[model samples]
Target: MGFHSFESPYDWSRIDTYRRRAEQCPGGLVDLSVGSPVDPVPRSVKEALAAAADDGQARGYPKTAGDDSLRQAATDWFRRRRGVDLDALGADLVPTVGSKEAVALMASLLHLGPGDRVVQPKVSYPTYAIGTQLAGAQVTTVDDPANTDSWVDLPGVRAVWINSPGNPSGQVIDRAGLSKIVRAARSIGATVLSDECYAMLDWSGTTQVGQNVSIPASPCILEPGVCGGDASGVLCLYSMSKQSNMAGYRAALVAGDARLVKAMTAYRKQVGLIVPGPVQRAMRAALEDGEAVMAQREIYSRRLRALVQALTAYGYDAVMPQGGLYIWAQARSGDCWADMADLARMGILASPGEFYGDSHRLRFSSTISDDQLELALERLHTGA
Candidate 1:
């Protein structure tokens, strides 16, 4: 009931202060702050959106639970892209505006409040904490899931967030590691919600897609291999923003735990949180085209290599991102914002580590255009 009681993890003040300075910069700022993709949406997706918009029936109110065709596409995409067993997931598939909203609202839908707690990574996307706070729940930050010590003593914890190829760290949780956490969560009768928005971007050399790979670099929490066989209290939140460049379309889905999905769908329907007709069309088109997603992945791979090498040359040791469009790096000396300021002065602006609950590290995104990426590399080399 109290508005000011909710605490946000992000440094809203600092971000606003930085925004002002970035606006005045010479070549306009080379923003690598948020992981928003800047690439153009695929033509297939665009064409679909336009066609849906021009349809006479599209003018009416869209279905809150998503159209049958969109749901089927979501079903197919998970089966083909993530290797999730549709039968195992059961009736637990529902559409959302995007993964961000789904991730944040899941806490509330579960009725987590006051005494309840949510466990999340120490270095995590800020929304995890914000979501818990908004639900009137406590947040516990764990550095690694393999540490059983961190799992005990949190009796009131109802959910544990697992972000593979994590947002800020780009660390992939393998099958063995995932099994440990899933077991721990299940033991406590808690749910394991995996934010796998970046699961399609694994880059550990062996391709998770195409012809050669056996196991994926990033394992899904609901994967039979990772869960040792059940998706009991699990859910995977995914978005088309990253892989398909559909950020503006707000296309995403929640899959797993049929009961949970039903509850969420009811709540969402009551609140009118539905994807637009045209956006749903675009999502279906995007999911149907695996080639476009692969092409996008290759582009990110090249940019990631360039950024990692350049950051190393700039005297920063960057963690090799196993997947995702980010490179986590640490400056040899001083705080990360100081490092960010240095980069900004050199004409390249990187997200300060502080944003992701990390003080000593910085994140570089590989979502820029080729020319901008080359310029960023050049600036890094000259320390401009």
Candidate 2:
């Protein structure tokens, strides 16, 4: 299950060329390539972490399955925010150091191996393929995540990874769409892993693809309307990074099938993959602080709105994403590298569509400061 030498699925050298070009501009580079949070971590979360650190009870090794309070908080958050009703005893929830690890290790954690097939959207985070490869599984892609006919027939299907408010694409999947995938996966006994990390940043009415639901954000895979309230083989991964500005904390959790949660928790314990006590407390604080989350959402809304208008006028044919922090703009002939070259000349660094398995677009993150965004706008309005 291990390779003798490390190989990065992403080609950093390719992007570095554009970064160098952007750096050469007189005004300096306005990097919009990454999704890292640039805002301050919420005060309540920091206070909770500090309190936990000093408490004698929290100084010891934390539970791999997560503390009772943290688990309850996660379950409650799902109910109030995502319309997911988890088990009473919290058997359906397990905290991870971050959602990324959970995502990268999911195929293996589910005991998938040689000959097993894992399906994901064509335009998706690269980690999905990495995780599948690590587990000795085959990877397949469907152009549309909601199209059940596209993936239901793949041989030896074991897992399905769906990200809404998708990375790079910034497209949100509606409830009806999510339900179709759940139904298809169930018929084939495939486990579905739903990444709803950006679910809280729903920029409704400007969606490029799916319609925004009545929920506070995007439709969740575990919602009753989606899975019929039976989370038998489904899991939803949520991160506190973007919404709570807790990226540094590396706090995230997965909620789903009780059996599956128990299995993954056991595997994690055996591997000593546990969230630190203080971080666990911090995550619980984030889950309860809805006001702080909403404030952060509004901040992103303004930033994303500003970028969409700027890119549109710059002739990128940009559409405001329904959710997530990215602005997915059109590129000539779906030539991502060419788009990168064009943007680089303007002293703007962005992610090429090739990075996300796309043909004709580029992604710009809105996580930079307002001043940096204004700088980008200035550069866009004029040439480098």
RMSD, one per candidate, in order: 2.5, 3.2
Q: Candidate 2's C-alpha lDDT?
A: 0.84
Runs with alpha carbons beyond 4 Å of true place in candidate 2: 1-9, 88-91, 205-215
TM-scores of the models, in the order given: 0.93, 0.94
Model 1 pairs in collision: 346-384
Q: In candidate 1, what residue range of length 10 has the lowest lDDT sum?
A: 206-215
Backbone atom clashes (below 3 Å) for every candidate: 1, 2
Give the alpha carbon lDDT tens digit for every residue of 56-75 in model 1: 42898788778888888887
lDDT of 2 at 260: 92
Location of the lowest summed lDDT over 10 successive residues in candidate 2 = 206-215
- Candidate 1 residue 295 Cα shift, in angstroms, is 0.5
Cα-based lDDT for every prediction: 0.79, 0.84
Supply the TM-score for candidate 2.
Answer: 0.94
